[model samples]
Target chain A: MTLLITIFAAVICTVIWYKTAPKNEMKVGILCWMYWGASLMWFVDAIIEYAELGAEFFTPETADMINDSYLGLSVVALGLIIWLVILLVSDPKGVVRAALTNKK
Target chain B: MACFLIPAAEAVITTVAAKIIKAKEEKDNGNLSLTDIKTDDTPKLTFSRKLGWLNKLLWGGSALLAFEHIWHGEVVPYFPFLTAVQEGETAAMLAEMGSAGVLMAVLITTVWLGMLGVSYIIEKRPDKASDTAEETQ
Candidate 1:
């Protein structure tokens, strides 16, 4: 489920990034990369778990599914946080700089 | 877990790529001066600038999630470790967390849309006012 959710987010972000393409000012591309990276991580996790549990991995308990969902959400949230930090540091629009200087 | 490394790597790669592209664009446009690129007064509806709402949403949503996790005692006081969700948690607890997660995602996105609307109005206001002033003259 975590893998699925991240993959979904990655797809949506990618589509938005693609539409904008070489003119990305919002840097949605970064978000897309983050989610896709997460999706790949979860994909490997799922594969390993599958190898260990075989067919039983397909029949996860409800609690496990819910746990997976939470994990997925956490990953998505973390990705956003990292992206936000990057955006702030880069200040591509110089909004932060402008605000700082204006206050002086 | 090692999963976190993926996003960390992605962040670095994307940031570098973005910087490169921005530099290339500025060079192509002959705006080689750093100040000219950084201090442009006119908000040229560039793709990155338009994503301001999204950036805000992500920041807000992430902060909210972190707060909620802390409140739930999910975070532990240790280095290189956080969160308590491991194998063999109760089904009810997982369900509750899952539901909350879904709600968070939905609410964040909705709030982002609302912010986008507000920002759109704010962005247009200056232009409208300037046009009005010109007309009055």
Candidate 2:
């Protein structure tokens, strides 16, 4: 499936980046945070969607609740992405720099 | 988890691929003597290496999510919606959901792979030799 291929490709690219990054830069840290945030949001969204799908549709209210939950989680995910972008812009240095320099 | 396993598998493949490329480059350049040399003077990756850890983190997150979904969501109750629907509709819905999950995984992995590809290209830049030599001393 396209999904499998894309996921496989993403892993390759990430490893390549890891191997090639500068010891002094902080960009990698920001990216890591962003990835974690996105993953959390995605997990939440998936759970909500799965829950909605599996439950019996006894009432319209239940459907609406699931929809609202999905929307809310999406907003949260968007917020995480925005925050990551800010972190990325604020410190152009890779996070590795902070750890290294902290020793000095 | 599929996310981590898939990527780890890909990394092994990449290493193999890299070796093949290196071998080919050596053959073309007539530099068998230079093949075993590992130089730190490689050019900088356009993307940072810190990004690599994200894959592990995401994989962990997904595993947790799977656990939560199975334990908290209760697997048996989770799929009952299928039975509630018309007989013909259940299979289609399940298929659709499965497809969506696959798509999401692929999208995330693709971005990860793109970062790696960029890093490789940047690191191979010819200018890093001076930097490498300087670092060696």
- Model 2 agreement with the true structure over A1-104: per-residue lDDT tens digits: 11122233335435655876755243444334334424543543455455787654333476566654554344334434644666555655556457667965
Top candidate (TM-score): 1
The alpha-carbon lDDT assigned to residue A68 of candidate 1 equals: 74
Predicted model with the maximum lDDT = 1
Clashes of each: 5, 13
Instruction: Tell me the TM-score of each prediction against the true structure.
Output: 0.47, 0.34
Off by over 4 Å in 1: B1-137
True-vs-predicted CA distance for residue B137, candidate 1, Å: 49
DockQ metric for all predictions: 0.04, 0.08
Docking class of 1: incorrect
